[model samples]
Target: MFFILDMFILAGIFGFLYGFLLQKADFCFTASLRDWISVRDSRIGKGVLVLIATAMIGWGIVLTLGLATVGEVWSMPIGFSNLIGGVLFGIGMTIAGSCASGALYRAGMGYIQFWIVIASMMIGNLLFALVYDPWASDYVMEPLQLAEGGFTLFQLNLPFLLIPLVIVALMLFIAFRQFGWSGVWQGAKDSLQDFKGNPFTKSHWDIRFVAVLLGIIATIQFVVMSSISITGPETRIAGVLLSFVFGDDFVYQNTYLNGMFADFPTIGLGPEETLVIFMIVGAFVSAILSKSFRIRKPKLARMPYAVGGGLLMGISSRMAPGCNIANVIPGIGGLSISSLIVVIGMAVGVFIATAYIFKMPLLLFQKMDFDDSGS
Candidate 1:
């Protein structure tokens, strides 16, 4: 009972932090892609690097201490499916104007378009479930296991965890040193500043801070995985509740149901689904407090973008074994090679879609003009 209560509390706190920071930072892959493709904004690019660097460092620490077993985290099969799935997910993000978590957070902010996007996502997931057989037969590489004993940085037989720690520390020092004291101070000031004037101010440094926090938050995944095995079911449960409230009677059956509620050592709800639901709730509560909630219909032409993008995410999440928030970070931190592939695929997908397909304009300039029009 106490452990269960602690899970709920930890989840709540985690969700709250994500909701608060995500809203404040406007940290959407969609926006980052837009900036990269259209306006050449490299802040988000820098942020991605920070996330990887910090995650690798943190993972090294956990490995040395034996605090958690990296062997348990989800990994991709690493082949054509990962590449294809990544491309599809990228396209969807461009069109929908957000990724899966981004959609939820925006929905919390009362964005009207994401209703359709989320609906499309669920539909896509259902379609994937139905067609999973062919996918299983054709594309999957043999599931990776730690027993195979492949070479890794740690596998090279380095002494003490401090070696990687020292390296990471040095790299971080160099990163800040390159920017100098003024840049460091400016970055610190900007992260704490109000969100009115310039959104990109000190964003490069802020990404590092966000990455560190995300790494800490990510440690919870170790606990979540050790305790649960019912990810898709939890997601389905939340979707069912929402669908029913909205008057939909879709009944999609999953084979994992009976096993989920059992208190057997290998059974329970997956963290991905639980985290997704609570994060949405946290975003909702945060938006209300920040008074940033507003409802507006998306442009008609953008509808296809939302629907198509969501469908792609559904397919990719299934193919890659998890979504960005779930599989990628934890997979990487846990030293799963498959997560690296998924991240690569996701990045490439974003690049191709943003550079070629969606081509959303650098709208920051236009947002100022839109404000000018109202004034």
Candidate 2:
């Protein structure tokens, strides 16, 4: 009992840190991709890359110290699952105005729209779990054993230091050309000054600060939790809800759902669920403390889009076997081939959603339609 309590406490601490930093930085994956596509603003995207690079470095150290192994890289067939799932997720995020992590944190900030998204996402998960196998066999190819012959950057035997160094060098080059040394220095100084103020009431941390903190938090999450993801908790919630509605054996009886549970067993509120709950609590507290908490009721017309978006997000996340936070951030950090495939598919999906569905300008320098009042 004491051990369980301690685990919950630790999960809550990590979740709270994740929520607080995410809110302060406004680090929504959807927003990062949209900004880069629409306005050529890559700051948030670069921050994401920084986070991945930092995680890679941290993982390298962990491996060097024999604290962990690289065995966590997901082994799945390289096929249409990634592309289709990623595309769906991208479309869902665009319509919902946030990804899974973004929705969770924003919902904590009292966004009614995100609540709808969450509910719809649960329904999507339940539905997809019911039909995963046929979809997998029809679309996904034969399973590739990553440890045996499957591809991964880590399999290439490259120096562990090379990946992070390359990413950092690219970021520096972009920053130097875009902001210059003086501008960058001034921005850093301003960020420092902002940090010196009362974080609870006066100001929030800068994006760079949030990025570094997220990297460190993710690293710690790996060391402590043995897994890092925001979607796992939602999956547990869906499973529990299904069991309540259908019967206790609902998840265990179903083939796909059973397989899912095999990987992430739902035996009461697990650490992931606890982490998610605390994430919401932490975000709410942060919002209240920052005087930013307010009920953001969506326009009635937008509710349908939110629901549809969320449903798509849920389905795609499950099909891909992970959401952006689960598949993209940690996946990239671990140099998984599946992550690379999913990223490509997501980029394509984002392009289609932004350009065709949302009718946003695809080309850089093109004017963006800021008015989202109409569908």
Candidate 3:
């Protein structure tokens, strides 16, 4: 019992940290993607890339020493599941205006619309129950599954060090050509300097600080919870409700359902659920502390998109057998082929949704985060 309590407490701490930092950084996968897609803003994307690189380094070190809870790389299976789900997820994020993590944290910031968005996500998860046996099994997922063990980085013993090394080299190469050694030295100095006042209580941290810290948190989460995703549990709330209505045995008909909730919580206290729940709580507290909490009424016109997008998010997250963060942070970090497919599918989905449905710009090659004149 105490051990369980300890795990929950740890998860709560991690969730709080994530929520606080995410809110401060205004980091959302959807926002990052949309900014790049609609207007070519790469500020958030660059931070996310840094976060992925950091997680790769951190998890790689932990895995190398066999310190992670799971003994091996927790690579997802290579299948159409990731591809199909990723596309759907990307569309959902665009529609809903936030990914699962972003919505949770934003909901914490007192967005009334996202609270509904959160509930809609649950509905989306249960909706999958209806499709799992009928069409998804033989037609959509199984026959389309291309590989059993995902094309994993572990298969080739790929070193995690390569990510940081390459990133450094790339940055230096750009900096040298642009600003020379003086600029590179200035960048290094700026990065290494300590934050003023209490770093923990402040908002608007550097993208690098936020990215590296988030990576550390992700590594800790993997080691502590042994779960690949927060989205899995977020959506599993629907599963728990599904089991409640259909009974566990009936719901267990789907193998994916069975595996996802193998240790289904009895008192709503599983490590996975606890983490997400506290994440919301943590974000709320962060918002309150930062005086950023304000109830923004959701526009009625946007509600349908939130509902539809959320449902799609729920379904696709499971379909991809991953989430936005999974595909980016750990997914890329682990170098899983399935993750790569999902990433591509998501980009495609975003392209379709943003360009066609919403009539957003499709300026793919435009220089992001540049001045209006592209200077």
Candidate 4:
């Protein structure tokens, strides 16, 4: 019990730090994608690449050193669900202007719309549960009713780890040529100083600096928790919420829930749920310290978009068997094929959603600045 308590404490600390960094940087994956796709600004997008590269490298070292086992890492399997789920996830995030974790942190920052989004996410998950019996065969894999036909890249016999390493090396070279090592070193120095000072209101760290740190933090989460997932906790929390409406015995009728949430023979809350709960608390603490917590009412016109986006995200998260964190971090770190497919699908979804949202004609060059007021 003390060991579990220790893990929970560690998870909370990690969550707090992550929440602090995310709030300080105002980093949203959707915002980054919108910037890259709509206005052609790739600074945050490039930072994301750096984050991925750093994480890939870190996970490679961990794997090579045998610091983590096969069961310790979360790798999505090869499946069409990844592609389909990514499309829905991308579309939802673009519409809502926040991904799952983004919504959580922003909710902590007192965004009423994100709170509504969170509620809608629970609704989406519950709705999925009600319909899962008929739905899993078409979109999800299972060991119960369905025979899953997919495998992770790590399960392959070839030199799959080298692919991520080589790609990371190439990205490092490109980064060195573009930004130089001295700039990064200087940025790190400035970042540490900023961390020690007034990071809430005033920050001097480059996004790249934060990006690299985020990569390292992500790797740490994997090493400590066996795997990192943002949506798993969401699902578990949603399940807990639904248990109030329908008893646990009745809710577990959805076999998918049985497998995913059940640690042994039971389905209930644990460290994973605590991690996300603390994530929200951490974000709240950050907002309080930063004086950024304000209950801003949602725009009347955008409420539907928020709810709709939340529904899409929740539904797709289960379908993909993961979310942005699931696919973008450890999944990619482990060189999972499903994650790669999901990335392609998400890119395509973002392009289509952003274009439609902006009412932009694809054939024409766009000079209008990306508007985030709706978010």
Candidate 5:
């Protein structure tokens, strides 16, 4: 049908833009946390916050206009699952040298190591799918939902616009404070100037520029696809592949995998799968065009660490039931309490992992591991 075709086309367009901007900005969640914790450089982390704030503002406006409802808001329990899952995910990303989205983009750039990480991640998901039911029933509490009269920032009686505005102001202050007012103005003026050489090869985009563009793109994604989560496609793909390898009954009989497979309900590719395929293609195109694509092998010393990290990320993502892009981005936009808790847990996980990996004195001092060049 034309409707389905149109959805695929839109998904490709959005996926392309997502891949291109992510590649150009070199925006990896693990790097952002590591840089900030290790070096006191907050540019990348602040850019991520700006992206989240901008998405929140845009989503609010869309809600006010009745253009769309909040879609794909996870109602999982805000308890041990989020805490353990987030910490594991954080540690995993640190080891893997990239988060889920980061791995995808880097894989497109011909990093064979990321390809391995992707494979490990798929296996991890399969493991999670196998164990989710027992784990959820035994450990997870009842799902805490925002839609079912659960607490939310918007419900605090403050003006709805004020929350996002305040968040935006705080994020901007954090982002621009390192550069004095004069420096900020100068940087803006410089960003406006045109490149004198080849646009693709010579030009570099500012983090803020990419963040704003990401916000807009994410908003458009919500309008078109009625959902916005990078991990959804990956998870779905894993389910389909597992089903093929095993039997349909094996996958469908399992509770967690069945829920995932049932969401798509198709033997062929769906919108989420289409988005992921094009996202890789777009990243490949961008890397090639930018002259940055190269087949690089990971350091032998770090292979085990990378595989372990990928496994952790895969299992934790399903346990949390979301990744950074899926939970943090949209969760913050929707003002979910569980999302905030996950972010805190992730930060703690990053801190602990960084201390262990870099061998920092007292676990807080700066000790850069120049020998380890995985990221």
Candidate 6:
């Protein structure tokens, strides 16, 4: 019970931090793609790189300390699923106007259209669940082998964690050297402040802080892993919850339950699943308090685009075995060749989504018919 309490506490803290940072940084990968493709903003990309670097460093430390194993990390197989699913998922994101993670995080900010998006997503997931049996039997790739055992840069005979950290840090420092710390000016401060004045300069210190927060989140993951030894489906926890609505046989096959539901049976929700729920709740509560909650109505005509995009997201995630956070962060940490493929898939998905699909002439023109706001 005390452990559960501790886990909740830890989850609350992490959730709060994630919400706070996300709100402040506007760290939506989908939006990042949109901004970069539509305009030209490297800040979002920089933020993502920082997160990857932080997770890598934290994961390396965990590996060295033997606190976590990379076995599960590399478990995802790469085959035709990689190319086909990835491309499809990319196409879905372009249509939906957000990625899976993007939907989760932004929904907390009170985006109303995401409400419909998620409903569609849930429907899409249910569709996946129905088809999973056949798909599992037929699709999926073989295990990928990395050159070395685990996630160390040493395996590749590269520099230590600090070396890459320093190099990246230096590059960012040079890039933002001239910015001011004000809200409206490039040289303004990066701290949470009103953007009423000059554009705030994002400080090196703040970047370091966010990076450290990300590292801390990784560390807490170790604690989470230790506290609850169960490693059932996490990304699909919502799917699991929805299974109840659909009479999931795996969850309630008998009076006592069975399958994945019974395989790792426990008294209550798993730590990570509970944590994810709290994260969403925490973000929502924070948004309400901060008065940042805003509803975005999808353009009526583009609704089909959103639906099509969402469907793609569902199918692709089912094929790829995970989404961005699921595959990339832990994937790189565990040094899975499949994850590297997923990263390639992610980049490919982003490019295909950004350039070919979302930015296409016909789609944009159609979208403009609904949202003449010139979004």
Give the TM-score of each candidate.
0.74, 0.88, 0.87, 0.86, 0.87, 0.71
Q: Runs in model 2 with CA error above 4 Å? A: 1-3, 73-77, 133-151, 263-266, 362-375
Per model, how many backbone clashes are there? 2, 0, 0, 0, 0, 20
CA lDDT of each prediction against the hidden true structure: 0.59, 0.74, 0.75, 0.74, 0.73, 0.55
Candidate 4 lowest-lDDT run of ten:
363-372
Which has the higher TM-score value, candidate number 4 or candidate number 6? Answer: 4
Pairs of residues at least 3 apart in sequence or in different chains that clash in candidate 2? none
Task: Give me the runs in candidate 5 sitting further than 4 Å from their true place.
Answer: 1-3, 70-76, 134-136, 139-159, 173-179, 190-197, 360-375
Over 1-375, each residue of candidate 2 has an lDDT whose tens digit, in order, gives 223677888899988988887887778888888878876788788677767777777766665566766565443445567667788888888888898888988988999999899888888887787776556444442352223333556555766557756766787788789899998788667655656657766436677767777888887788777556766568778787788788767678777667656654343566777888777787888888888989998999999899999999888887665788877667777677776777777777777888888878665644334333333
Candidate 6, lDDT over the whole model? 0.55
Candidate 1 global lDDT: 0.59
Give the candidate number with the greatest lDDT.
3
Model 5 over residues 126-159: C-alpha lDDT tens digits?
A: 8887776666544452352223332346545555
TM-score of 3: 0.87
Candidate 1 collision pairs: 92-309, 95-305
| Segments of candidate 3 deviating more than 4 angstroms | 1-3, 69-71, 158-194, 198-203, 244-250, 253-255, 265-269, 362-375
**Candidate 4 lDDT by residue in tens digits, 260-328:** 665634556677777777777877877887677888898999999999999988888877767786687
List per-candidate RMSD values in Å: 7.8, 4.9, 3.7, 5.2, 5.1, 7.6
Q: TM-score of the candidate numbered 1?
A: 0.74
